[model samples]
Structures are given as structure tokens and as C-alpha cells.
Target chain A: MNTVWKENALQVIQDIFRNQFFDDSLAITEHTTPADIEEWDSLAHVNLLASIENAFNIRFTADDMANIDSIAVLLATMVERGAC
Target chain B: MAEPTHMLMMAKEHCKAGEHARALEVLRSLASRHDPLPMQAQYARLALTIAQGLEGLPVLRVAFLAGSTLDHLVGALRFWLLLEGFRLEPYLAPFDTWRQEAADPSSGLYSFRPDLVWFFLTARDLKLEALWGDQPQQWQEAAAGRAAEVATLARQVLATLPATVLVNNAEASATRVLGNFEGSVSWSAASLQRRYNLELAQALPAGASVFDLEHLASCFGLERWEDHRLWCHSKHPFSLEAHAPVAFAGAKLIAAAKGKARKCLVLDLDNTLWGGVVGDDGVDGIRVGPDAGAAGEAYAAFQAFAKSLSLRGIALAVCSKNDPDLAREPFRSRQGMALTLDDFAVFRANWDNKADNLRQIARELNLGLEALVFVDDNPAERALVRAELPQVAVPELSADPADYMRVLAEGAWFETLTFVEEDRSRSRAYRDNAARNACLAQSSDLDGYLRSLEMRACWGDADQARLSRLAQLVNKTNQFHLTTTRYSEPELTALSLADDAWVGWFSLSDRFGDHGVIAAVVLRFRGQAALVDTWTMSCRVFSRGMEDFIFLKIWEVAKGRGCTRLEGAFRPTPKNGVVATLYDRLGGSSVQQDCGQESRWHFDLVAPPPDLTHYIADANGSGN
Candidate 1:
């Protein structure tokens, strides 16, 4: 993985989650899963994905949506697609 | 709360200064426009500003009964309606329980008594999947059946309370499971959904309107509009970015239905309407009309837009801070232009404040200041009018002339429920009215001038042929009589056919042109007296003596139907005091008076005033 790209992507994703979930101080690590955050419901997850796409200028396929259950999985998918 | 954005800070300052409306203006512009701020950031930034602290702003209670979860739309709708100066009070019915909530009298929907009820349903809600491979017969039957089913739900809510209802037709799924064959086969989901959409619209109860969600989705591009992933995960109807546009459009539609539509568009000259200042750049130098190439085409397109508005009954006027002669030069000598000087009803070119000029335009047109919308390219002028005359709409238009039409069209300032035949002549009628008023000012002999005008009055029942015009007048007229009620078409239809009721549509025209359905009145017969249910007339024909002419026919018809007396009432609004003494002038005696509420009047059929004189003659040439 590109260390700089991974660091920047995580920062963007963290800000989106913080803003959309109305928690100004939310933090996420690569190990975090959907089960760890109660507010990471389907509605918020969909909104989060859209916000990331808008911020990163990328599109996500349906397979990516289904496969990305954890932050580690999300990073891995981004790395595999060279989005990172 | 997070750090407030610059626009949010402006809203907060306005709130602090007791300028809640101004605050809404800032926030609404931020949300409605395609701003640089991302959707999630914008939505998150505006979440806490639901404005519950503001006092005395007009409130609109809205209930959303949708097949899918609408938690996000409710928030965005608040920001949109706030721009229209209404605080939203939303009641989101439980997911997919719309049928139950609408049917049960004791449901929260009925108890909440929303001013507007929205029904957002889709193909899945119609249960077309059950008929999947079943024959083409079930496709047709299911569409009709499901439409009737949902229409019944709407009727149930309407029966309990009087509210504006908007139903969303089913969207044709983009999946295209049968690929290109979807268009060819009647059994395809998309084809069946299209049929369901048509049936749903046709089956809706009277006064209810379809929201055209399918068209909206198509405009947004179906690929971007739908997300099967979100649908499967949470049953979200459309994409998250779709919410803002939907809410903005939905608010404009509701505003139109509530009679908040604009009647006049006031344009600014110079670089605003065309390219370059007329004083600096002569008619030949001014970049307008098609002769001027690309930049000129932009101005011509904007000019074409204003012309189209005039053709559709929206009065146009010119207010420029330049010399009158120079301002008139462009429209007079310019060739290949989309507009002419004759297009404008009122033209004032002087160094007055544009805000006061807008007021003068409204005064000359006999319309309220609320009826006018000011468009100017100068930011200072826009800010000035927005500050001085808050009632007149000043859109946050982009500086680029190429974007003017898109901005204006998206603003949806001039929306109407129905278009009457008279709308085609409405702008021209305003122009002619100026001539009539000028004639009124110059003539020493009022009676001679009135007689010389040669006015004609046509009267008829509000039958199917005239129902649309009748409904248009009733909806547009706020206060032309004792009671002010905007009746729907179905209600007007029932009244016209009722044996014990007499409803009339009055059309008046002089040598100028035809004024279609200028006035309409409804009366209910009970015992020996006819009670006036509603009597509304367009403000355009005021002072034309049409009132007396219509009153004469009212009594003639009432007496023929065995009525011995007539009862009416006078309700006062802030601006309708011009007609405060109307019933008195019509020879009606005060029966009861309730200060600040209503005043009742009674007129005996044994005698109408012998001196009730009008210059208008019957269309049949039977002048009595």
C-alpha cells in the first residue's frame, strides 16, 4: 500500500463520517468494523459512501458496497482498484 | 455544533437581528444552488438549524407518507420551504404504513392535520411483482387495481380534512430486466410501471396532483438517481444527492398550489437584460439579439425567456437607471431581437432606487408588491431590493448571462395550477388597462367615457366547458367578495350541477380584448334565501362595473329559482379593504356585524336598488 495515499484517504473518510453522523470527533482505524459503530447503519453507510465518492472523485460498484464491511476491507478494495 | 460556515454565520446573524426571513434567504440559497460545498457537508451543516427558536414565522404542517424511508428528505424539505418563508412542521408516518395511516381516522395523519400531504410510492408498493409472468391481462388489471387502491387512501385522508395532496407516480425501474425487450413487451416491469403511473394519476381524487417523480428521475439521469445497493440495504427510493432538488421542486409546487405564485417579472436594463449599458453602448453597439454572435445569443436567449413568460400571462416591465430615451432605443430600433417595447406593460427609465421603481410597477399594474419579482445583474441592486422590499422576489442569479435562463427557470417563480384561455391575453390586458386608466384620468365626463368604451358582459353556468376557467379565477382571487375560499374543480363541478345551487362564470370584454372568466360566484339555496358560498373575481377587472352587472344577473337567476332574499358576508384581509363597502354599494343592508371577523348583509328580493347603474351591456344585446 502507498502510505501517503492511505493516510490521506483515511483522513477524508474520517471527516465524512464525523460530519454525516453529527459526531464532530469520530475516529476510525483500519481495523474498525461496521459492528463497532452503532450509528453505522445501512442508511448512514450509503450516505457515507456517496460523500466519499464526491470527495475522492471516484465511483463505487455494487460489489464494493457488499464487500466493504470493515474499514480494513474498504482500504483493501481501494488499494486493489488503485484508488489509494 | 461544528464550526459554522460563512453562509451559516450570516444566517445566525440575521436570526440575531430578528431578520428570520433574511436568514432563510441565505440558508436557502446555500442549499438549493449547486454550491461548492459537498452534499453531506451541507446537509450536516444545516441539520441543527431547523429554526425551532424563531417565533411567529408562518408554519406549514407537512406529512410524508411514503413507501420508503424519508428521514433525509424531511430535513432538506425544511430548508427548501424556509426559503419560501414557511417553517416546516413534518410528520413522517411509519415506513410502509401509509395505507394504514391514511385509512384509519384515528391515525396520526388525521390527528396531526397537516396542511400538505405527500404520497411517495413506487412499483414495489404497487405489487406488480406478483403478476410477473402471469399474462398481460393481470398487468392491466393490477395497474388499475393498485391505482384505485392508492386513490382510496388519498380520498380517505381528504375526506377527513381539507389539505393539499401530492402523489408520486411509480418510476419505471432502470434495471430493464428484459433489456431492450422491456419497451416491446407489455409484461416488462418498466412498461407495467409506466402504465401504473398513468393509472395512478387518473385515479387520484379531485384537487390532488401528481408530482411527476418519474420525470424528475429521468431529468436527474436514472443511472445517478437509483441505487439498487441502497434499495436492497435500506429501501432508499433514490440517491442521497437527489433529495435537495426534489425538495426544492416540491416546495415550489406547494407554493403554487397555495397561491403564492408571482404575477409580474420586473427586469433591469443595461448588462442585466442585455450585454453592455445602453448609454455607454448605443443600440448598434449593444450586444443583444442574434446579430451579435455568441455573447449576443446568450442575451437573446435570456430575452426570449422573458418574452415567453409574457406570452404565458406573466406581465413584464422595464426599470432602468438610464435616460428614458436611450433605454427605449434598444427595443425600438434594434432588429433581430426577441423582445420589443410593446412587450412591457410598464416602462420606467430614471435614476430612482430600483426598489421604489418595483413598487411603482406594482401600483401601475394594480397588483400587490408581493406579485412582483425583480431581476438585476448588479449585486448592489439585488441586495438593495432584497433589503428594502422583502416581498418582491430577487433570485440569487449567477453573473453569467448564459446561466440566466437556467437560474430563472429553476426558481419556478411563475407557477400556476391551471392555465385559462385568458392567460394568453393577460399581459396584453395589463398593457391595455394602462390605456384605460389613462383614459379614466383625462376624461372630464366619466359617464361619457364609460359609455364610449363599449363594454360587453357574457354570463353562463360553470359547466364542463367553462370549469377550468371558473376554477382558475376562484383559485387566483384571494378576496373579491365577503368570503375568500379557493374551490377545487371537483367542488366547483358539484356546485354547478347541484339543483339547489346556482354558480355562474362571468366573462367581460370591451374593444380591447377578451377577458376570459373575469368573475365567478356560488350561491346555496336554503329555505327562501340564497346564501353566498363564494364570490371571487380577478383584480384585473376591478372598477369596470362588472360587479353590478354580475349582481343583477345573480338576483335575476336567484328569483327565478324561487329565492326571496340573499345573504352575504364581508371578511376583511389586510389589502382587501378596497371592497369593504362593496355590499353597501350593492344596496345590501347590514344584518350583523362582528368586528375584526366578518360582517353579514341581507338584501330583499322585493327590491334591488333602482340606481344600480353600469355602463356594461349584455352580450346578447339586451340592455336593460
Candidate 2:
């Protein structure tokens, strides 16, 4: 169960980042942050968050909108919302 | 369960990857389909890629003066316009700089000279915040002050430019502090904001039109209307997906202003109008009403919707590949039927290709093929027509009869800003043409046939009462328009009052019925030449010698005004090819050809040719 959940969550996050940024080869680890990618600006960050929220059927608060800049924060929000 | 929306995006994606052939196929699919674009078009970067590949599309300069961030919305706007065969050249004013751009004449807004200026000021933009227990007068004061500012800005835009201005009504407040009682509270944010929208719409300048975002929010559902989290991050009023409808509404408004609105809704018989085939299952066996159960009721409801559309002046037509009597029997003898034979302007039921039938229908109704919106239940028939005559809009109708009315209404093919008595009387004029056609078959020769109809015409100076029809003629008449110039009703009124110009309207009546205001003319009295700036006639009277009757009066009025020469230009369009040699046939000499695209023609008024002959007698008796 743990292995299946991790794979599915990883696939969903990867697909959202790939489609949203239109970069097919893009890969993300939990530690990845805005400083690691040049395309993840403030506007693109909102787009990425919106895509993950839609994919997970969840909502984010205003604090999360401004503070969630790394893949670690996104996974934490997704798990807190019972997405995993 | 593949939605048609997903398939349409293939065109842009394929074109992005340089797959030309696949892109062409999907673009063809997008063209043949009906309804609006989907939300996936919000990717601004992708839309630019698709737009860059398209060649020779008409360009509309649009300026967005908004209080919110517009970086993401511009892509969806350009995507919708591109789907409608127009490329959007938009100038985005800096965030919250609308007041500065609209007031300063030398600002970038004026220098861009946009054809459409979109003002998007949301409720938040106006600071209509909900109060816990503030004074009731506070809400009213804020609403009224913002309303007055919008009205003043609208006047300034109209005074500075002649372009069409689209002002979005503020979205009602999402915070319903009083819940169900919010509407009843005078000082509540929802109540005050609603009143502010009404005041702004009513007080706008004559040329500006409201976009009605409040009504759009209700339809789109206020729950998902705006994202608060994204608003805090980007200052965008709504999420990217919600901008789809806004973009579509803007494109349709621009299209209607340019006279690209579809005029006719052509339907098929058989399973289309009833639950069963009319020919296979006879009129009595067909199911089409409340008594015929569920499927029949759906067809009946669709029929009622068509009747309402005809009342609003959208010409209805029937095109079927069956025997004429069998196809029309349901309307003839059936009970509980919403549509009757009289509702349709033209009925073509024969064993011919649907595309050819549509061509004949357009010819009989005196309309361009682009003016038709064809609806059929058969996919093969829709595909054939789409491939052959691409100008005709063939909707991707489902097999379910219940979805017919919804699909057609969502197409919004007949979008118009104004409706007049003239529009309501359009079907009557087209129906009269049928009787005239039957008379033509009985007469022997052209002259003898026209004489038998007993046609009488009335010509006079176009006044306010005739402004609607005159504007329709000058703006929408594609064929036989000498100059093809467009003018709003207000502009036309101003031109009529000028001393050096003459604007006249002509109406014709025959034994069948009256065809009201069939032609309009605008002539500028130059020193030695009376130039014809505009000459547009209804296509319904195309071959009835109406042009001959109209041109005789043209030079006669110019000669009476003491002009030595009568001059005009033939500016060509795709649909105006029928009138390429109009001035030449009118005994006028071609003086100059501008790059072989537009030509100038002249007629010597001092020694004008003999007046053209027509059978119609003058009823007003003022134009000698």
C-alpha cells in the first residue's frame, strides 16, 4: 500500500508539472524548490498549486498560496488533505 | 466518452510541434464544429504559438484597460478570436492604470487606436467591501460614487474615439453576510453592488455596451467564479479557467459589431424534427409532442425554441433529402406541433446533396452561405456539408433530441446588440419572395414578368424612423455594396444632417407584400463630383431590377445637386464578387485601378446616359 501510494502521488505531481510548464522532461523531487528551476516564478507557482489542488480535489489557503514554494510543502498539503 | 473539446486542442498542439498535416485536419474539425472554445485555451504561451502560425486572418486591435492582472486572460481572448478567424492585437494597460489611460488622450490606449476597448473593473476593484455593522449610507455612497466614475469614463472614451467600448458589470459580492436576507438589506454588499451595475449600465454612453459579468457569474456558478487564494497571489479577479467564457463573450460581441453574426438557422427533417423518420414512419406514426412520451417532448420543445428564434427575426429553413410532401407532412397535419409551414422561409426537400440544397436556399433567401447555421442529426450529412461548403456552420449535434435546443442556443449565432421592428419583419419579407418566385414561372419574359407584379417604390430622405434598416443595409449588406462602408445608426444620423451629403432610403412593395427599406445610399457633394460613399441594397431583391431602379435615381439626384461628374469606388470582398463590374454595367467609365484591388469609376452627369428601365412605379413621387 505504501509503495502504490507513493508511485501514484509521484506520477500525479510529475504530470502536473510537465503539462503546466510545457516541459515534458521535467522531473521533481520532494526537496525541489523555486531556486532549483528558473521557470517556477510567482505566477507559475500559483498555476502549479492550482493544478495540484485540482488533481487532488483540494483547496489551499492564502498562506499556502504565498508560502508553498517547494515540492516538500506541496506533498505535505496533498497528504494533509488525504490525497495520498 | 471523448469530449469534442479535447479533440479541438489537437490543432494548436500539433501546429506547435510542426506537424502541419495533422494541424490542418484538427483545424478543419474546429471550423466545422459549433459552440464555444474550452478552458484549456488559458495557456497564454501556447495560444501565441498557435496564433503565430495562422496567416492572413483579419486583425482586431483590442485594448484591455483593467484593474486586475491581465497577463493570463489575454491568451484566452486571443484564442477565442483566432478560433473565430480573427487575430487579436491586444494592448494591455498596466494594472490599475485604466483611469490614466482612458483620460489622457496621448496615452498608449489612444496611440494603439484599438477597435474594441474592454473595461474590466470588478467589485473588489471598486472596493465594495462587505461591512459587519457599518452605516447603510456607507454602502450606497461607495456604489454611487463608483457608478458615476464609470459613466464619466465611458463618455470620455466615446468622445475620444469611435470604437466600440465593452464595459464589464462588477461581479456581485461573494460574501453574503446576511445570507438569504442579503438582497433585502439596503446596505448589504450584494444589494448595493447589484444596484451599482444597473446604474452604470443605464448611464453609459450611447456607443458603449455592458458585458453583464453578474449574469455570467450566476450561469458559471458563483462558487467557482473566483479563487481567493489566486487573487491574493496574482491579483487576478478570477482563476485562469473562468476566463474562457469572458473571452468567448468578447469575441462574439466583436463579431456581431462587424456584421459576422449568422442570419439563418437551417434544420433537417426526419429524426431531426421528430423522434422517427418522417418518410419511413409516416406523419401519423412519428412521435413529436407531449402525448408521444419523453423523446417526443424533447423534439416538441426544440420546435418551440425554433419558433421563438423565428419571431426574433432569425430566418428558419428546411433542407432534407426526402420527398417534399413526406418531409413537410408533420407540420401540415400533425397535432401539438410547435412549428408550422409558415415558420420557415425556404423549404428544400429533394434527393440532392445537403450542401447543394443549402446553396439553393441561400440563393432563394438572398443571403451569403456564411449566414447559415445548419443543424442535422446525421453526422455523415453534417460532415459532407462541412467539407463542401465550409462557410456554413454545421453544429456537432448529438443523437439525443433533448440536447438540440441547448446546443443551438449555446452557439449564439444570432448575437445582436439591438432588435427593431425591422428584424421581426424579416421572415415575412422572405416568405413573400416565394410568391414572387411562383409568379416568375408563369410569365414568359423578364420585362413582361416584372410588369405583371405591379411593383411600387417609395424613396425619401432617411430619417430616425428608418435608421435601423438603413444601418443594417450599410453595415451588413455584402453583395452589391459599391463602397462597403460601415456606419453606426448615430453616425448615419449625423451624416444625414450634414449639408454636403445626401442619405436616402428606398422601400419596395409588390402584389405579394411589402419589402421595407430595401436600399440605402450615401452621397457626398464634392465641388465638381458627387461621390457615392455607400450604396447597399437588400439581397432579397437582387435580380428584380432594383439596382437599375436605384442607380437611375443616383445620378439623377447628383445631377440635380449641380455636380458635373458622379464618382464611386468598388471595394471588393469575398461575398461581393457578384458586383465586381457593377459600375461598368451602369454606363460608368473606370477611371483608375488601385493596384488592381480597388477601382474608381466615374459617370459624366452633364451628359448622363439614359435612365435604366424598370417596371416599378414611384409611390412617394418626390425623386424626379
Candidate 3:
């Protein structure tokens, strides 16, 4: 566990989310809605999901991601997955 | 706010460059920024908290419980807290109780409808932890029983919560926990991970994959203290550092790992073997003494290492830029050199571009370029080799003589996972290949040369026995690959098990030598077309037209299966340009084109080309 791990994970997730959602300002937060982040396409979603999984060492089922539409949901999912 | 944003960008840049301390400074700067708008201020505060969290600083999360308007901030804080590995028990308790009371239809606060109360509680707990260190052991003990009670209640409330809300809570919590455990662990980190894994598993519906702290730990090699040093200073728990070891260990672990070169080192002599030119020094004049004054010590160490690799099943070969007679003399002379001519399987010491020499060496040794690691001290020589033959791994050696052996030994790129029985005889096999090549070069007719050796091909579905060799070819054979698709064992398993797909591999041998599994073809049946997903041949058998024979075999299989045409895609890559015209040369017509289009070749099975006679059909349909 180093200082960089969390930051790196956060940055990578952010970059992926931003790139996929086409919105750089979208903060990865509990309340951030997927609808607000335009880059949340199906492919981007899967890529972000996989990237986050790889980054944090957590896995998400399709159903788990299906309902996760906001930054809050993502954060909660990370918690539920024991990655947080 | 803009300052914070700029600081954040700078910090991110520094982190990418492997400067963690510098990144922390920027984050600290951002944390000091002030904003007028509550939302902006709260965003900055959350960022500061996350930065602190990354640094392993436990600060209690600040809460805005004044009104419903603060709900968003509360939720955001909760998300950050969970990512930082803080427990959410204290935060969820009040929300669960309120939900239970509100459901009775008799509560006055029912109209209050705390949409973000749970999120607020989560944020407050984090703020508490941040401002005050870890919660007191007594507080934790007292809260543990109550926490469980709250969790039970929360579950009941959670059932009625919007899916988005539930998912958001879950995601935020998981991220915080994962972030904390990813690179930093004390007693709290491990316990948090364990507890969270169970909690998340329980909270998540069935079939949801949980990315737990343990999984993150292993994926990033976080369990090992030494490995943690790679990413301990970064913001994210996972990065290139986490994956580096796995990449290093990838050559070894087969079940979850992928492509690796075989355990045979085809070495170059002359400048490669010793510091001074070997031809100029002669056997006796060459420096091999332990004296600090002598340059030959490095050569001696290099030989010792090479011998060690040989003992470990790595076959050694000599491809030098020197007189064959002069090079052979030092190895055999009584002056007691560490390496002898017999130490190498194939010794090709001639005045030829090393690339061509390497090609000859591969052919003579019956090995693929992918399996060979060419080490030469000269930059020009290394570059020439790299440009002409990209498949062969030509690692650049240091000009400093002292680092020669150390570089070879420590570099994980050449590491091997498993040593098989045939590895010991690799040198001898190459020696036979050299003899075979010599015989073929002397013969005018190709068929006569192939027949003289009495070649045989063995075809079969790859099994555990041949997995290593198959992987080696896949990793190293770059020139003739159709798609050049690389696969780990798991990926290969998926491909093989996928509907309408099959992997066919072939190994060739002759009285000359056994050319271990050197060809792999991935065939996919898609509707009317039998797509050759991946097709590659070892460079050793290039001019012999083994590809033609292989193509003919594939055609026969496709024709029998009632396929109209066999389609092959030639995706151009940096290395495979040598065979860019393969489809046109192989009698395949182009059907379509797109921007950055990989050349698509379609061969109607009704009129397959006449089989070339250069190779005699062996038991496995491979040409001799």
C-alpha cells in the first residue's frame, strides 16, 4: 500500500470515465449521474468497469454495473466489492 | 478553484512520471485553496480528503447536515470515505432507523424524506476519522454489535431504495476500501478488506463479481513488501507498477500467463563474447585472467552465466562477426577458455550482416526467431538485426564491460517458466539443423534435399505436453503470422472452446533435427466462410514454402467442411511488413477495403492452388 495507489487508481478511473463520457469535468462522486456523463456508452462502460476492476482488484457482474449509473453508485459498488 | 485544478493536473503529471512526493506537494497546495460557493468549496474539500486518503492520512470526513440541499455533498463525501477504507456503520445507523420509522406511516419526519441522509452519515464518519485519528478501540468494540444491528436494518431499507442510490452507495464504499488496501495496509487495511469482501458479497446480488482488497493486492503484487515500493507513492493502488511483476512472472505462469521465448539462447561471439576483438587477440593473447587490469574477466563471467543458463536448459548458439577458423580456435585451445565450440549448438562465424547470420542460425538450428534472444555489444549491429528481423529479441548491451554478465542475468525479459526434457538437447538439434541447411544449399533441387533428410511432420491438437513450445512460437514467430494475435492460457482456452473455432498446430522433424512445434493456425467457421483467424510459420522454414503446404492443408479441411471460401486477413504491423504481399502472392483475391484496412484475401476452395512439391507429406501433413 503506497500513496500512489489510490491516486493512480482515481486518476485512471477518472481519465477512463472522462474519455468514455466525453466530459472532463465530471467528478467521480457518489452523486455523479451517468446521464450527465455523455461518454458512458456501453463499450466505455465495459472498458471502465474492467479498468476499475484491474486498478482496484475488484470484479463487477453485468447486473451490478447495470444499476450503477452515477459516481456515487460506482463508489458504492467499489465498496460493496470490498475494493474501497 | 482554477488553482486547485491546475495543481491537480500537475500532481497527476508528476505521478505519471514516477515522482510521488512532488504529486503530494501539488495535492497539498490544492487542499489549501478556498472557494466561495458551497458546492465548489465542498468539491475542493472532498478532493483534499481523497488526497489525504491517498497519503494514508486518516482524517474524519466533514458533514453538512444542516439541510436537504447539502445532500449531494454528503453523498460525495461518503463515496470518498468508502474509497479511503473507512467503515460506514456509524453513518448508516440513523438512516436505517429513520427509514424503518418512516415506513410505519405514523412518523412526523416521514415528510422530511432524507434522500441523502445515508450519504451524509458516510461523509461525517470519514471527516471524523480524518480530524481525529482511528476510532478508539473501545468505540469500535461498542459499535461493532450496534453496527451489525444497523446493517440488518439498513438491508431492509436498502431493498426499497432506488437501484441507482443503492449502487452509488455500494460503489463509493468499495472504492474507498479498495483504495486504502491497494497499497497501504496495517492491521486496519487487512481486516477492512476481509470484512468488506464479506459485506459487499452479502450486499451485492448473486453473480456480481466483487473486486476485493485481496484481489487488488494480488493483481498489483501488493502483498509483497518489495513490490509495494513500486506504487506506494502513487495516488492509485494499481498502475504499471502493479502489473510489472505479473509481466515479469508472465513468462513462467502458464495457467494465467502468456507468450514467452523458449529456454535457448542463441549467442553471438566476437565483440559479444569478450571485451577486445577475439580474432585480433588469438586464444592465448585473449584476456581471461582474474587480474583487475584484464578486460577478459567480463567475458569469463559471461561464459559462466551462459553455462549456468545451459545447465538450466537454455541451449547456447554462436553467431559471430569473425573468421570461423579464428573463432573456433579460442573455444578449443588449451589456454582454458570458459566456453568451448561444443558449448554452442550452431556456430556461424562469418563476415555477414548479423540479421542474415541470425536467419541462417535460426534455419540451421531449426528454431524460430521468436525463441532466440540475440545479444551483440555493437549498437549498429543490434539495430541492423532489429530492423531486418524484428521477431528475434535483440537486447541492447551496455558498452561498459563490467555490466555485461549482470545485465544478462538480471533482465527478466529472458526468464523461462518451465524447463522441459528436450531443452537439454536443443544445441545438438541446432547442430543437426546446420548440417541440414548445408545439405539443402548444396542441392539444386529442393525436393531431392528434403527427401535426403527423410523429413516427417507431426500434427495434433496442442496438449499440456506441447503447450510451452506452442506458446514460444506464438510469442516469437512474428514474420509469417496472419493476425499476429497473442493469447494468454485463459484467452486461448476461451478461443478453443468458443463455438466454430479450432486451433491446429504442427511440429516438423527430419533425420537432421526435431523442429519443435513451429506452426500454429487458428481456424474459425463463420457462416459460409472459414476464416483463418491467425496463421503463422517459423522463419526457419520460410523459403521452403511450408506456408503453401499449410495453406493447402487448411483448404482441404475447409473444402471437406462445405465452406465456399477460406478468408485470411493480413493486418499490417511494424514487424510483419515483410509478408505484406502474402495474400497477393498466395493467390487470394481482395474482396473489400476500409481505411487502415488490413488486406483481406479470399481463396475459393473450388480452385485451390496446386500443391507445391518442395515438401514431402509427413505423417502430420507437414512437408519434409
Best by TM-score: 2
Residue B184, model 1: Cα distance from true site in angstroms = 7.3
- Supply candidate 1's per-residue lDDT for B561: 83
lDDT of 2 by residue, A3-83 (tens): 677678878888777766666688877788989888787666766777777777887888777768777787777777777
- Where in model 3 is the C-alpha error above 4 Å? A1-84, B1-282, B287-298, B310-323, B345-403, B416-431, B497-499, B594-596, B606-609, B620-624
Candidate 2 reaches a DockQ of: 0.34
lDDT tens digits, residue span B77-182, model 1: 7767766667888998999999999998999999998888898776667767534577877888877888899899887776666677888887667776678877
Ranking 1 against 3 by DockQ, winner: 1
Pitting candidate 1 against candidate 2, the one with the higher DockQ is: 2
Q: Better model by DockQ, 2 or 3? A: 2
Q: Per-model TM-score of chain A alone?
A: 0.90, 0.86, 0.69
Ranking by DockQ: 2, 1, 3
How many residue pairs clash (N, CA or C atoms closer than 3 angstroms) in each of the candidate models, in the order given? 0, 0, 74
lDDT of each: 0.79, 0.80, 0.54
Give the top-scoring candidate (DockQ). Answer: 2
Please give the TM-score that candidate 3 achieves against the real structure: 0.48
